[model samples]
Target: MYQFAITGLYQQVLGGEKLNQIEKTGELTSSRFTVRDFTELVKIGIVNSNTITAFTGMWLAFQLNGISFIQNVDVIFFTIVGSALIVAASGAFNNVIDRDIDGIMERTKNRPTMTGKISGKRALMVALVLGVVGTIMLFMTTWQAGVLGVIGVFLYVVVYSLYAKRKLVSNTVIGSFSGAVPPLIGWFAVEPSFSIVPIMLFLVMFCWQPPHFYAIAIKRKEEYAAAGIPMLPVVKGIERTKKSMFFWVILLTVLPFFMFDLGLVYVILATLLNIGWLALSIYGFKMDDSIKWAKWMFVYSLNYMTILFVAMVVISIFL
Candidate 1:
């Protein structure tokens, strides 16, 4: 029953009449997701717990300030647990809302909600519970941080999911705003000060998302079309999608210069990275290499953001 309790379901696959027998379903078939299941994912490092839980740690690291390692533990527990709950809730709810749409798309057809492994009513209940718990955790940080968390939730669940996702061609843009706020939340966790630096960090992420998603839409155009989701590549042409991706990558490259006054190190490094990113963009459009190039761009986008942020943290120290 522990396994059943963990996943929140049990099944009764009975045999025919003559020798009818009841056998306990050994394998978990999912009736609902339990807290234990979600928490275990966080504990094991499958989904991201860092950006959610490490707000104070990121702030401390970015500042290059020394704090007792002991203190970090206390901070990590509260921030990670709280933010993770919210993220999980948001994710589960997104699955519930998009289940019908998801079933039409190849990539999402196997999700619990899409497959009828979890009920809509149950998923909604979990989302609300997790959101409330997450908000409470953020409240423990400071009212400002709590407000930011709430904004992220509201932006994602309501504005993006409900209103923009189905109606707008630029749904991803609205979604990116909420996604990029994690670093900002980290920036403000300790200091709670609004600055050009943190705002720039947000913009870099904000701008980077379009191209990243454009590449994805290009790769998954047919799935999106089948799903009746009007992604950029589906509504607009592939050529338009490529051009849009190129434009956004250029925008991401140019953003750092306006915000931070870094030395030649950043300038040279960014130029080289941008050159590579743009080259991939160009290859995606001009060459027959788009399928390969789109995948490359997607992979590199993850690293590029990580390296860029790390560079920012590094530059913040010496500059």
Candidate 2:
């Protein structure tokens, strides 16, 4: 029933002409659809990155709650795999929805959705299967985790992608909510309750996204402008975007203080990472070439997130 409903919605949104093009090209059954195309469509990088945070959240929950990891292998597996699949589904949905604008942006032009290597119907089907299965797995782990997963999908697909991306400059901020939910899902899967640790983890991820994505927006401002996407850098100019990044990075510095229970090592490491990011954010104002500075900021943000989450799991276990 759900499948039929989704197919109807796709048909309505895609219209007769686009559907005919897909059918006439026979791309769905063509040899053009490779494993690489599928991975790209689902954004494996995003899946892997979010899964790390989810796993970190679960591992920290186990340590904090005095639970044995060895005894709950099934729960861990479900939490991580479910989280990854949901995130991947979100990516696939984004690809399908953004296919038009994606073709305009150089960075996204070669994607399977934009290139028509994968049909809209096929991508939608993949997203539906992954989303339903992932949601079921999360529900098996804990209702809280399952609910968070659903909320995350709603925010990413309906709120951010459908509305905010084209209509609002605050789209990145709105999208951050979905990106931050993975860790919460992981924590709830293990503990099934609220706590400051998970909240801090959520804030850490939430704050990290703006600076990270704003940098990409800065580097690709012209492409985004041509695509008519209201990314911060595209809509608000580079200087304003830099100030926003600085603000978020500053907020990120304060979150580690609230996560003190993760120990002095985690706190100290997080503090240093925050300070480094903050320093880089400050440097952006003085740079002559905004693109070069944004690139630097982008690279640091990736390293900062990976290190911070890894520290959380490591400190929780060893300390």
- On lDDT, the candidate that comes out on top is 2
Tens digit per residue, CA lDDT, model 1, 107-156: 76766553444555555666779879988887776677678878887777
lDDT of 1 at 267: 70
lDDT of 2: 0.88
List model 2 lDDT by residue over 98-169, tens digit each. Answer: 866776789998888666677777788899899999999999899999999999998898778777888999
Give the CA lDDT, 0 to 100, for residue 10 in model 1.
16
Which run of 10 residues does model 1 get worst, by summed lDDT?
10-19
Clashes of 1: 1
**Number of clashes recorded per candidate:** 1, 0
List candidate 2 stretches off by more than 4 Å.
1-31
